[model samples]
Target: MNLTKAIAGRRSTRDYTTEAVDEKLIFRLIDAAVQAPSAMNQQPWTFTVIRDQALLERISQEAKACMLATTPVGAHSSHFQTLLSDEDFQLFYHAPVLILISGNEPNQWIVEDCALAAENLMLAAYAEGLGTCWIGFAQGYLNTPQGKHALGLPAEWTPVAPIIVGHPKSAPAPIAHKAPSIHWIG
Candidate 1:
């Protein structure tokens, strides 16, 4: 597919089919991800591909449990409590493959690099007739003891985002765009 078509087709998909995504496709997406721009070409990013069903279920359950452990009296706790009921957040829309993007350093530039990599992978999946959702909740999950061991990430690695990739159960409708506010340019 052409770049324009791929860009136009990409969307944040939270619904996925049970069909297993091929490992080769995941590798291809990661290859595209690494090609993304990095800060001074430091390439501090790491990709963790998770495919085990038992591990995925464990992570989902543990994430909910950890989020529920927050003090109920806290202002933010109620929000977390409500999140546990959401199915998408619970199982990550049941995507077959969960790609965790981690950065070696917590430098601000590393976040930018990881974000670019995520975009590249998402577009790559879209072109391959797949769907993707960039999940931020995985970061919180990684902070918990269970999630840390589940992904087997090193102490130095910081989980940035979880990219859920799989066959699309339903394609999201086109989102309307608003014109950006801009300053004058020469």
Candidate 2:
């Protein structure tokens, strides 16, 4: 797939099929992710691939509970509250694979670097005819002590991106994007 097409056509896949993604494809996605540029070549990302269905379900439930228990204070809290209150919501969208991108160190650019890697992974998945969704809802729970222990993450590593990858049951309609706001300068 052309880079432009992959970039523009990649959608956040919520409904995934039961078919498991091949391990080779997952590795390819990781290869693309790590190719992303980092600040000072720090490359501070770590990838945690979760394929256990039971564990995925547990994390989904725990993450929802965690989000709901927190005091609603932000502008996005109401939206999240709706999701949390919904009994059928699954943070990973039942995807067969969950790729958790963590930052090895706490630094100002860690999140940004990991996010760049995430975008690369998502686009690569799309190019390979797989679907992906970046599940931000899992971040809070995945960062907790229990969550870290459950995933066997190092104490210093912080989960920055929780992405679900799988075969899409159906393709979502193209989402219209807003026009970019540009300020021209000399």
Best by lDDT: 2
Q: Which lDDT tens digits does candidate 1 get at residues 1-186?
A: 999999988999988889999988889999999999998988889998888877887788777766566436677667767777565565576789999888977677877888999999999999999999987655687855567777788777778778899999888999988989999989
lDDT of 2 by residue, 1-186 (tens): 999999899999999999999999999999999999999999999999999999998988988998899746799888889988898888888899999999999888999999999999999999999999989788898999978998999889989999999999999889989999999999
For model 2 the TM-score comes to 0.95
Candidate 1 Cα lDDT to native: 0.83
Which candidate ranks first by TM-score, i.e. highest? Answer: 2
lDDT of 2 at 136: 78
The lDDT per prediction is: 0.83, 0.93
102 in model 1: Cα distance from truth in Å?
0.5
Error of 2 at 142 (Å): 1.1
